[model samples]
Target: MSKVEDAVAADAATLGAMQINAFDANQPEPLFVEPYAVTGWATFIQRAASSRSGPQARVGVIRDDSGNVIVQGSRHSLTCLLHIARDNDAAADLYGPWQESWGAPPPDMSKDRLDAFFGEMKAQHKAVMGNVPHICTFIFPKSRGGGGWLTAPMTDLEIIMTHSTARGRGYGMALLQWSNEMADGFGLPLYLDAGEDVVGLYTRVGYVRQPDELRTSKSLVPMVRAAVKV
Candidate 1:
């Protein structure tokens, strides 16, 4: 296999090991119990690595010297990162324009209206879907540096739980440490988003909460139609 392919294989092996460890230790439910999880994560890794974009993605798997897999983690470009800004103008713009253009009318709530609403929603969904993989990586990295002088260039992290039996062995920490080493190697600041429950985990590792990010969704049929015609 090519070097890149070898790396990917090694990474996948690490992920499998990590998952198996987590499962055995009863840390939490595994993200994927069936074949879907393994296939899905593999697809994501391949796509990210092949993409021609600014945020180059990479997957790292920990393995034994004999090439046995142990744990896995991934990183993606920062542009895909999503932040729910406290005062997000883009979201407001997307919904506000539509809400103002189409007032509350029965026809506005009719089947056609519903169709348009769904259409707009689909478009927004597509836009966001394109951003999910990369942003997800940024939010789940192993280590994040400080805001100013300590910042590093390679800043995104996403830890992948490939197996359930691999938890409680510090594999997660190892992945984060690996990512941090990459960031430090490149001299950049690391950043990630955490769910409310996992915020403490990140804090313990030097991640602090930024301003609370919010999300708003609204119907955008009229705007989309107008753009399409233009």
Candidate 2:
């Protein structure tokens, strides 16, 4: 395998492990079926790597010299990100006080949702950075459809903290800084979605609330199921 291919595989493995670990650590009831998490991430990694637009999407991980994977983060395709945000607990936490939110947790291996999300993402792949692991968990950039604004564009950062132990370690800041530099390099306005608890953190980094655009939802079914599974 080429070096990049090897890297992608390693990253996929790391991310899969981290996702499972994070879920186990934080959820009162963990829902990952052992093989599913690993296999699922592997599938994502392979597909992304094989795609023509794959290289532009970055995947990163923190590892020891022994090459053991530690932390992993990803920037889902815009559509994937949208779906993720729709069902994301972390996003809900960030937006809870602002407005009521609702959605079901993503069903496992929902072929239709996955296919549609991925297909749309691939069609707009030029604007996407595939599941970036660590040091910019989830950042996305977009251009206005009609205006064709050239000099400046808009970008969004969506960071997810799956492990409590990973908090306060500066990893989050590192990721934010990396993302900001990337956006600044492209001369795009940086945007983000953060929970109320971490508002101060983002504020310190120069992010402001888009209060008018804020909306929230709660999924009692998913939440309860997650609790029971844990």
Candidate 3:
């Protein structure tokens, strides 16, 4: 089929599938996902903010009685990443400063040049429906790691976050419990990589660290929550 035909088919497939994956207290018009996979509720703030035009990933969210977003989480498919990857400026804005904060300098590449690079990769990496479950979560070696490589999870629980005002009210636990249930229903393990400071929180939620998992410069350690029979 032609590229336009392929895009139309893909979007149609995503629509029906999106309903089954909805994860939120109140849907976000289309769908709602919790903001981020937050641990250590004590450290409720994400120091760095990444700018992006919009997210192409699946998201879940929790809200207070007043209709405010209290918690959030998300999972990105390969197709989602491909779009963001094509939108290099958005990707850079979203992650560039986060990389810089880790003592790694930002790339010197021009915006056009960077887009061309990812455009090449987008052309090369064609994702089938089956690959959606295992999406890219973290890029190894980091931008500062001097290697530009991405590592995907078998099933990713990408980002979970809770607002400071909403912490200690059981929102974090609730969101995580929901995540567990969702994974169990899918019969796929939920995977994530965490930093040393917040590892305890995940451990409490049944995330077990693999011995082979190592921390990169960003200090991410791999952990997984096996699918449970619901």
Q: Pick the candidate with the highest TM-score.
A: 2
How many pairs of residues collide in each model? 28, 17, 20
Candidate 3: stretches off by over 4 Å: 1-56, 70-154, 213-218
lDDT of 3 at 130: 20
- Per-residue lDDT tens digits for candidate 2, residues 98-207, read 11111222455354543443233222221222232111122211111111001110132322322333434455444454544554554434433333345455556555
Off by over 4 Å in 2: 1-7, 28-34, 43-56, 65-67, 71-164, 217-230
Error of 1 at 6 (Å): 8.1
Question: What is the TM-score of each predicted model, taking all chains together?
Answer: 0.43, 0.48, 0.41
Window of ten residues with lowest summed lDDT in model 2: 219-228
The 10-residue segment with the lowest total lDDT in model 1: 221-230
Q: State the C-alpha lDDT per candidate.
A: 0.34, 0.33, 0.34
Q: For residues 2-93, what per-residue lDDT tens digits would candidate 1 score against the true structure?
A: 01112353354334333334332342433233233244345445644584333444565545445545333432111111111112232233
**Ten contiguous residues with the weakest lDDT in model 3:** 1-10
